[model samples]
Target: MWIKSARIVDPGQQLDFTGNIHIEKGKIKAVEKASSPMPGTMHEEVIDARGLWVFPGIIDMHAHLREPGYEYKEDVYTGSLAAAAGGVTTVVCMANTEPINDNPSVTKYILDKAEEAGLVRILPAGAVTKGQEGKVLSEMGLMKKAGIVAVSDDGKPVEDTSIMRRALEYAATFGLLLISHCEDRRLSEAGVMNEGALSSELGLPGIPSAAEEVMVARDTIISSYTSCPVHITHVSTQGSLEIIRNAKAKGIKVSCDVTPHHLLLDETRLYDYDTNAKMYPPLRTGADRKALLQGLASGVIDVIASDHAPHARDEKDLDFDVAPFGAIGLQTLLPAVLRLHFDYGLGLMQVLSLVTVNPARLLGIDGGTLKPGSRADITIVDPSTNWTLSEDMIMSKSKNSPFLGETFRGEVVYTICNGQIVYRKNGI
Candidate 1:
């Protein structure tokens, strides 16, 4: 297979040029620039990717694939479909299912389901504590042997500082990354929207930024004290960014990711009881949004994840305060990211690295680069296409997305995983 004349942008190789890629046996065999053409002596699939953008298949380091439980919301197969459409060839799903992926059996179950689907690569994160109770430690060594890439309680924070410290140490013994969902339930008690004048005007409970920042502080300090790496997921506050930046400056082994929803929207959109806008570490003020953009520039933010939390239509239709706190984002991740490149004026490489090389390097995954001998996972995009996001285009079983009806300037035309075309846009 050959991808010809496309503007191949591979952050792994720090490459950006018109090129041709040759694939054989599900691996990249060679990357030839336009000036250096490969010998053409065969009849095989040749994609004329002219006037399009080719990138390393996008990798989402954090997401929720509700399998073994909550299939009504989303499951492994549906989540893989959504991932392929979003040009995400690899996804690391959180461990917050019915049984909670605290044991090796649950971890194996999720991996087995993903293998059966065979659409995209799915890695499960093991729970930090047994049943996610935050009381007893989970068998990290056994889970790691069962094929979990990391350990995290996913959406549920290990509230006990002593427990978290031990989790970090235990995870280190197995060389597993520990991802922390930094949230203090007490500080964010009964809150739905971001705390401010907007919540006051609407008479809804407000979740303060301090709720997320205090926990970020605690975890960063704990990581520093223990000298074990910690990854903070879905960071949304200005103070949290500052704390992470200081921690990094002080040589603390801590990293963080910011979701597209938190970076793109603010509390203003929640005035009407729009349930799609609700999420843990809810959207913040415009000032905080600006700080996040600046954080991307300052290198404080290491990853740009979708946090692809999906909820059913019925659940999202309820009142804002009564509805679940999340929105479907897998299909919208790429478009929202293009906004940063086209609208926010960030360099394309800098923006792409947040989703590509950065996450791949941090997570130690194998699919974020298009180098020779790597998996032939690729995404072809038309950056000039203009279209509005509609419900029918969504591949997730659930139809809860904050970006619905929003117009975007880019679209994924083809998604190739393991040298096979898994998704192609209509009429493309």
Candidate 2:
């Protein structure tokens, strides 16, 4: 396949230029500047990407592919399709499925399913605690052998500092990245949305910002003491960002990701009691949103993960108090993130890094690059396409996103995984 004349934005190589990408046998054969002489070769397929942006396909470090038990909400095949539709070539699925990905058997099951589907790359994250109970450490060494990219009890935070400290030490010993969900259950208990004036006005329960920041503090301190890198997931609060910033300044190995919903939406949207807007570490105040934007642009936030938690329609259609906390994000990932560049004055390359190389680096994956011999995982985006998201647009099993009906300026025109066109918009 020959992808021609596209603006290549690969932050890993620090390259941004209109170029031609040559793909052969599931690998990047060559990347040539548009101005260079064209090679004399027979091409079976050609994609003219003029006026489009070509990026290393997004690597979402945080997502929930609820397979092995919750196929009613989302399965691996459907979730991968959703991810491909959104330009994500690689996804690290959280270990929060029905049976939970704690042991090698479950991890292998997920990997085998993903291999059979053969869409995007799906790396399973093992549970940090056995059954995610937080009382005992999981079989980290065994799960690692089963091919887990990282270890995380993503749906719940480890409430005990001693347990978290031991997990950190074990992660250091095992040479695996430890991902923290970073929520204080006591502070966030019974809360449905962000805690503040808005919650009072709406007469809904609240989840304090301290619920996230306090855990961020605990994990950062533990990471510093153990000299291990801890990656905080779905960071939504300014106070948490401050703690991470301070830790990084102190030479601590720490990284974190911001979700699209956290970056684009605010607590005010919850006034209607839209359960789809509800999520763990729920949307915060406008000031927090501004800080998150700054964090992304200023490099304080390391990655732009989807946090693509999916739920059944019936589950999210209930009253706010009883509804589950999540929003389906895989299909809406790119367009929502593109707003950062269009509205927030962030450069294109910077925005691309948040979804691409930065996440790949944090997850320790061999992706987010267009160099020769690299796996041909690529996303071609039409930056000028003005599209509105609708219910039918969601490819996941559940349509739980709050961004439905929202219009955006960019769209993923083509998603290529391992040199194959897995998803193409409008039959391009």
Candidate 3:
């Protein structure tokens, strides 16, 4: 197959130019800049990619597939479909399902299900502790062999400091990255939204910035002491960013990512008792929002992930205090990154790296490039297309997103995973 006349931008290879990409046997065969396909290439499928942005398929390193138990909310098949629609070719799913992904059996189960879906790639995250109970370390080496790409007890933090340290140490030894959900449960306990004026006026208990900041400090410190690579996910507080920034400055191998909702929505979204805006490490003030954007520009934040936690509609329809702290986001990841480019003025390549090259490097994965011999995972986007997100537009099994009704200036027109066109906007 040949992608002709596209403005290919593969940040993984430091490449940006009008180019043609050739694929054969499900791998990139060549990247020829400012040139037409070779003679006799007409027999191959050629994609007219003119006027579109061609990127290495997006990689969302944090998301909840809710399989093996929470299929009612979302399973592997449905979640993979949503990911394909968003131009996300690879997803590192959290280990927070029922009967958590603590053992190799669960890891293999998730992988098996992903194969059945035959859409986007799914990399399971093994639990940091057994059953994610925080009492004992999980079999990291065993889970790795079973196909888990990383270790994280997302949707819940390992409250025991000793366990967290051990998990970090074990992850380092196993050559896996430790993805931390920086939240001091004690500080965030019973809180429904950001602990500020809006929560007070709405008569809702708030989750304070300190809840996440304190843990960020702890995890970074542990990472430094143990010399392990720690990745903080869904960071939402200014204080947390400062700690991560300082840690990185000190030569600590610390990296972190921000989510789309946290980048766009703030505590004010909760003033209307909107359940979709509710999330763990709840969205903070507008000032924190600006800090996250600045972090992206200054390179403190390493990537922009969806943190695509999904909950069933009935679960999200409850009272503000009782609703689950999550929303589906797989279908909005790339568009939100576009927001940073168009609205915040970050260079397109720079912002695209947050979802592609950066995460691929951090996770030690492949295919965030159009380089020769690389997997043919590409996302073709219509930069000028603009539209609003409604419930019907959501491809995830659950429809609980703060981005609902939000309009955006760009959209994915085609998503190619492993050289197969898994998602086509007009076709879907």
- Of candidate 2, the 10-residue stretch with the lowest lDDT total is 36-45
**Cα lDDT of model 1 by residue, 163-267, tens digit:** 999999999888899999988999899999888888999999998999889989999999999999999999999999999999999999999999999888988
Tens-place lDDT digits, model 2, residues 162-212: 999999889778788999999999899999889999989999899999999
Can you give the lDDT of residue 101 in candidate 2?
Answer: 93
The parts of candidate 1 lying over 4 Å away from their true place are none
Candidate 1 overall lDDT versus native? 0.91
**lDDT tens string, model 3, 294-344?**
898899999888989889989998998998888888999999989888988
Error of model 2, residue 28, in angstroms: 0.9
Candidates in order, TM-scores: namely 0.99, 0.98, 0.98
TM-score of 1: 0.99
How many steric clashes does model 1 contain? 0
